[model samples]
Target: MIAAVRVRGRTGVKKGIQDTMSMLKLTRINHLVLLHEDPTYKGMLVKAKDYITWGEIDEETITQIITKRGKLSGNVNVTEEYIKENTDFSSIEELAKAVVAGEATVEDAGIKPVFRLHPPRKGYEATKQSFKEGGSLGNRGNINELVAKMI
Candidate 1:
């Protein structure tokens, strides 16, 4: 899956990109959405790259995120029993593993796909430029380290 975090606020942004970001569910700064890496989502990411940072995430980070930040419908906390009752998996760890392994998706498990995270502990390196330019926007390859900091 892809982990996308909105890095910038909605100031001086075009309406088109704003719509794209909203469609990706990145409506606020520091909001994270776990999306499947499909071509349509890829195109949308490119369109909203100026406002967010996205990348491939691994199993460990996914587990930590689910355990710490995941919630169910109506703002309920995710628990081992919840996972067992709502999904085939018996635990959150297993659900996270399936998600990272591409065997299941956030939607499939009935968890809210959005992960509202605090800003990274020390903040982003820079938000004005792309990741390749030493900033925090755009595709960041494997972003497990960054995700950990946010978690």
Candidate 2:
């Protein structure tokens, strides 16, 4: 059920990239699960930073977003037991592969589950106008204005 989630928040662990975390609760996924042939992975509650404390899902999602092979993937496992057991695997891909190879259980993927994330359904980005501000900055006043103008 590999579905891309629209990330939310901008204050989590940072790597070379993953600049910002998702900040809104806006997610529109029209599709359900894709091919459920694979085992379903769950999520573990990590800390949250930027907003309140620290520890968020941004890092995991960003890592998984990479499509190129060899690139580390996001952690899809979310079992407390697994996390309690192993505290290694610097990358999500390593954890994922571990799960595939039966070395680790789905719960032991290290990364949180995927369902909690916003799915990638390609929805229009919200603008200031939507928030009662101006449009975009391209003559519309703000980015939204420019978008509406272009449309």
Candidate 3:
């Protein structure tokens, strides 16, 4: 799965990018969403690259995110028992490992897919330029560090 966070605010955003961001379920800055890596989602990401940062998420980081921010229907915090009761996996670690291995999905386990994150502790490098230009926007390759800061 790919992890993406909205890095920029809504002011002055183009309507197309705003629509794409909305489709990605990122309606606010610092909001995060996990997406399956596919051409369709990739196209959307490309369209909103200037307002978000995305990258492949590692298993360890996925586990951390699930353990720390995974939620369920009715806004319940995800717990080991909850996972065990609702899915084949007995624990969050198992679920996360399975997701990373492409054997399971959050939907299959009935967990909420969106994660609302805090702004990164130190803020972003730059939001107006692409990552290639030393900004935090665009594909980050590995977003564990950035996700950690927000978490």
How close is every model to the real structure, measured as TM-score?
Answer: 0.95, 0.25, 0.94
Q: List RMSD in Å for every model shown.
A: 1.1, 15.4, 1.1
What lDDT score belongs to each candidate, Candidate 1 first? 0.90, 0.27, 0.90
Output the better candidate (1/2) by TM-score: 1
Off by over 4 Å in 2: 1-86, 109-111, 123-151
Candidate 1 C-alpha error for residue 111, in Å? 0.9
Supply the TM-score for candidate 1. 0.95
* Total backbone collisions, model 1: 0
Residue 119 C-alpha lDDT in model 2:
25
A best-first ranking of the candidates according to their TM-score comes to 1, 3, 2
Question: Across residues 56-106, which tens digit of lDDT does each residue of candidate 1 receive?
Answer: 998778888888998889998777788888789988778778887789987
